[model samples]
Target: MQTQVRVRGARRWIMFGAIGFGALFLVVGLILAGVSVSFLANAERARGTVVALEWRNDHNGVSRKNRENDEPVAYPVVEFTSADGTQRSFRSSTGSNPPSYEEGERVEVLYRADSPEDARIKGFASLWLLPLIFGGIGLGIAGVGTVVALATRGRS
Candidate 1:
């Protein structure tokens, strides 16, 4: 005799959750891919002067050698005013290879005037890299989840 498995409403919900996570991962992955491509495609256009720079480390992005004694590092926020007279702020993560400009400096920034809030500093490739990395992971997971769901469908 073979072992039997049944999927009730709750189990179905569990499956739904797994699939939902995969779907969400894919969606987010796509969005990140777009952003990454845009950034790469229009790197020159993303250039902007450094208007305001602030530190934001609510998530503690920095640390010392041990990563234990280091305090919560904040980010460097640079606000820029596009040619259209609109101002936007871009955050520089502590771990990023690029360094943020000092206050009232003319620094190059890569960003979409439409959503300047999501941008990276001129020297920072982290912004562009992150999306690709995240998208790859997301898409890969989504693919695996899809395959699993299909394989275990009615039998679930």
Candidate 2:
């Protein structure tokens, strides 16, 4: 029947699309993991001072807090001197409600020699978070796609 043929064709296309997306996600995850490893290997360490806490409001509307004991997220502003003797200031990527760093506190900083502006607080959370998050999502998506492709192939 024409309808049966069309359904088969549609299932074939779905399988192909799922496989393609799975491959794409796997490749992206691998690349991100590689970059994260490279950064860890080559980063230089320096002493930095926390200059301030930058507050951020995540709520789209109304001034009321969204959750119990909710407070504005605060990211640290840090200043450090590079090996080249240039002073650089950067905001930390990590934020917390109670604030992890106090102003005028000294902390370790990790940065690339070629690009000092690309720096962060030297810690496990700052270093490993992005790669772990991206890789996890990518692997989850790819796994789902793989299951869909396999199930469709078995039916065929």
Candidate 3:
């Protein structure tokens, strides 16, 4: 009888943990989505050119396999003139292998008028990815937690 009671208690704890994690994810996802939307709403458009590719190494000085393939991630360095006519250069907030932008390539940019330095490549991937990814994961986690909690409640 003691062992049965302990098992039931453990199951309840597990259910609570799942629900807590799910709520956390959902809240974070909503926050991120809100931030993304706010950024998009107040951004100004600008024409910019990729001037260079900044390489970033994440190996922490540790030797690893395929050193050639492990070449640093390259983020584009963009130069643009703000609405006030001041020229500014900033590294892109996003990076990818094979590099999404090449040096000298013209690209559209979205920046906050108050802080042009906080600029981003204007596109679905760069702008919407964070919120979409987080929100999707949160929804999935919350759904799983709901299912687990319901199933365990019935057993209890």
lDDT per residue (tens digit) for residues 1-156 in model 2: 999999889877876776677667667767877876888799988999999999996565755755554568899999999999999999998888788889999999989999999998987667776667766776776677678877877777
> Ten residues in a row with the worst lDDT in model 3?
60-69
**Global local distance difference test of model 2:** 0.83
- How good is model 1 by TM-score? 0.47
Full ranking by lDDT:
3, 2, 1
Clashes of each: 3, 0, 0
Task: For each candidate, give its TM-score against the true structure.
Answer: 0.47, 0.72, 0.85
User: TM-score ranking from best to worst?
Assistant: 3, 2, 1
**CA lDDT, every model vs. true structure:** 0.59, 0.83, 0.83
Off by over 4 Å in 3: 59-69
Find the 10 residues in a row with the least total lDDT in model 1. 1-10
Predicted structure 3: lDDT? 0.83
Query: By TM-score, who's the top model here?
Result: 3
Q: 29-83, model 1: which lDDT tens digit per residue?
A: 6787686677767653434565544543343454345365334333456666665
**lDDT score, candidate 1:** 0.59
Residue 154 accuracy (lDDT) in model 2: 78
- Report the lDDT of model 2 for residue 12: 73
